[model samples]
Target: MMDMLLRPRIILDAAEAEDAEALAEIHATGFRRGWSADEIDALIADKTVSSHVLRRESLFGVRRPQGFILIRTVADQAEVLTIVVAPAARGRGYGRRLMEAALRALYRDLVPEIFLEVDEKNASAVSLYRSLGFVEVGRRKGYYAEDHGPGGTALVLRLKLR
Candidate 1:
């Protein structure tokens, strides 16, 4: 589905190192700790791995990349490496749109399911996944370390893409 605002113009750019600097800022802003430019470059530059940024109309400041999702296809499945949205864009439904686009882009044919891990304490994010029919499949102990009291666990969730 196309973005309403962009209206037949949503541009999905394969993020490069040059875009990493800006992506790092957004990632750091969304998560407490963001990756460095080199880190983003490493993850995105791998030809086998797919990294993308969703721009409203174009890559320019049309709507400065409100969200991002990274995926790596493994066999008949695709694992979501990371997904984030700018703090200011959190409640605007960008997260949902990003997930939808990511799933369609990466696993439209071979993969029938997609999986990801999410911090258990992130209620909003959990809710969003559940709303998209993601069911809890497992859990990882102490996966997220934060500045808060103690780092929380991560819940593994999966959704059938059929």
Candidate 2:
């Protein structure tokens, strides 16, 4: 086992168009209906979207993408399109780091609020959003179809930024 503190430094930075394939790979691990590389490319290409990646940089300066967050801003509001951490990178505070960075960017842009819809059954995700000051505002029944079970509801959450 390696010392957690001594682990390679984690870098959070803006994602570029070239990262679509890698982001899609990470997205597939976290979602039931994952977006393809082309879909991710289109989203990243859109002028309204802001994308960020969390990467682990080795002492030798090799960086590997570990997680990402995508948000779309319209007018004075923003919505989180997706957020996911690679399965191997879970439980390492990467998700929170991504969210905090995204929120800061949105806030700095003077966005009034941000919203996201999360599957109600995703306890870890719900907890993370709540810890970041997101409050449940609405829900969509049967918003997410499961692989082998009944569909789950999507809880709409909002956080005031301004």
Candidate 3:
């Protein structure tokens, strides 16, 4: 049984190449088609990409990642490549915290606008984006493959940071 009284301390930090495996593991917990560690490592190695990880520290001082977010920037614009929180860590405000941190970082770097694509059928994610002030600017048909059916549409959202 899980101990409800001993909550782990959540911490956010910049992601490094060595965190690729942990990021992949968290991604796999949330998505059916998760990116591999090699893919995450290659993306993190890119000069234009910035990533962050959310970690949890247990009472014994053992730390492990619980979520991650990846962003790519070009000139004054930035795009969220991906963000995922482990299944067990969902509903704990980790996603919102990650987005807040990423947006602040982008804003500090002089990025005036940011964008992201989310599956249209993902209500929770869509709601979260809306709460974060992102508006749906476009949609891509059949952009994401569904787990049990045909492909799904992807909603492209944009947020003005400036």
Candidate 4:
């Protein structure tokens, strides 16, 4: 079926330095302001950051990146820096999968809690985080820049990993 073919086999792997450009491209599609390839590369190279990429391997052995998630761990806690899925690949559960991968890795590492900030206007993203058991613990006023006027508030969400 078309659905089966499109699904393929997903392989989640630790993101490498070479993936910066691809990840940046995906990030650009998902955000108002995107991180540069250099920035993503630097994050991947940092000792405290954990980055994961999801690749879709087709029936004919074609492998391409669908999404990526970046998490920074400090001591007993971790924070989701960013997550983005390719524009064409959106709404196919890739975001959830990427978040799940990050959660599993953090849990395995014995991280007690994880936190992330999301624009309050991003309904889908907020919904996804809530579904994954994240609850809003705080808010930052006008934390996100807007094109025309005042920026939106950022909702700080947290999840207990332990």
Candidate 5:
């Protein structure tokens, strides 16, 4: 848990071209199959994709990115491609804030519904999504492979924005 007094000021902003490397680095901390900077750059260049980066600014004015959320929209629906927060920054409400900001942006853009897939075993993530009004619509059997054991299922969740 992060100490309240020690937590830095946080800012959430639309991701830009320069954020590709930072986004990739933060993503690598959370997932086994992380995206490369080049791949992130390509995705961000797409018109249908929108991304947000969360940054923390210290009292000394040093700023560093802590997390990011990437979304892709087609027609009236949007999908959360990824959401990652640095391990040290977890449990400090950054993930919830990032998701809130991303959802607001998608709603403003007229997206009627949003969807995402999460590993069924990730209790914290599942609880977070449920708190944000995402309900499970389906599940994929063995959608996520593990190194030491059998694969895990992926729960497909959807949130109605309109």
Candidate 6:
């Protein structure tokens, strides 16, 4: 196998309340409906998942990802409430890494199963989740508030781990 070398220095930390504005801006730039500053703040400040943020600081500027994986645990099960990558950061593997982190965090919590909802039109995201072993379990009619394109419903996926 070919060896990979070098990686971005991403500092994974819980998002501070102050980071919400930047987060929402980045998300808005990346997705169809960029969350409002207030919305992002609410999501991050929510007690449910204790949301996380990935940051990288340099002399030029600090890179604070607007997207995240919001997960919550219920008994032995974990649910991924949301996952996003900044518009400018897509295709850079941040989404996948964030996903891996979320899964690992849940695993560390001894969660044996995980589930999430995704827009069915988001083929890229669906592929990623499937690659990570999540299978489609159901669908929600008109679940997506805003759409990427083609306007599709939400798909529910689940992964059961040993």
lDDT of each: 0.77, 0.94, 0.91, 0.93, 0.91, 0.74
Q: What TM-score quantifies how close candidate 2 is to the native fold?
A: 0.93
Per-residue lDDT tens digits of candidate 2, residues 48-86? Answer: 999999999887888889999999999989999999999
Q: Ten consecutive residues with minimal summed lDDT in candidate 2? A: 1-10
RMSD of each: 4.0, 2.3, 2.9, 1.8, 3.0, 4.3
What lDDT is obtained when candidate 6 is compared to the true structure? 0.74
| Candidate 3 ranges with C-alpha deviation above 4 Å | 1-6, 147-150
Give candidate 2 regions above 4 Å deviation.
1-6, 148-150
After the best TM-score superposition of candidate 6, give how far the Cα of residue 94 lies from its true spot, in angstroms: 0.6
- Backbone-clash count (model 4): 0
Two-way TM-score contest, 1 vs 2, winner: 2
Task: Give a tens-digit lDDT track for model 3, residues 1-162.
Answer: 367659888889988888899889888887768999999999989999998889999899977889989999998899999999998889989999999999999988889999999999899999999999999999999799866766899999999998
Provide the TM-score for each candidate, comma-separated.
0.82, 0.93, 0.92, 0.93, 0.92, 0.80
Model 2 per-residue lDDT at 155: 100
Over 1-162, each residue of candidate 6 has an lDDT whose tens digit, in order, gives 222223435776777778777777776664667778787778676666656676754445666564676677777877886677776677877788888877777777678999898888788999999999999999987676644653558899999866
How does model 1 fare in lDDT? Answer: 0.77
> Per-residue alpha-carbon lDDT of model 4 for 1-162, expressed as tens digits?
988877789899998988899899989998888999999999999999998899999889976889999999999989999998998988999999999989999999999999999999899999999999999999998899988677889999999988
Candidate 1 residue-wise lDDT, 1-162, digit = tens: 445655535566667667788788888886657888788889897755676687665534454666688887777687888888777767867778888778777655557888899998889999999998899999988688867756778999998887
Given candidate 5, what's the lDDT at residue 87? 89
- Tell me which residue pairs clash in candidate 5: none
lDDT of 5 at 110: 83
How many steric overlaps are in each model, in order?
0, 0, 0, 0, 0, 2
Error of 3 at 101 (Å): 0.3
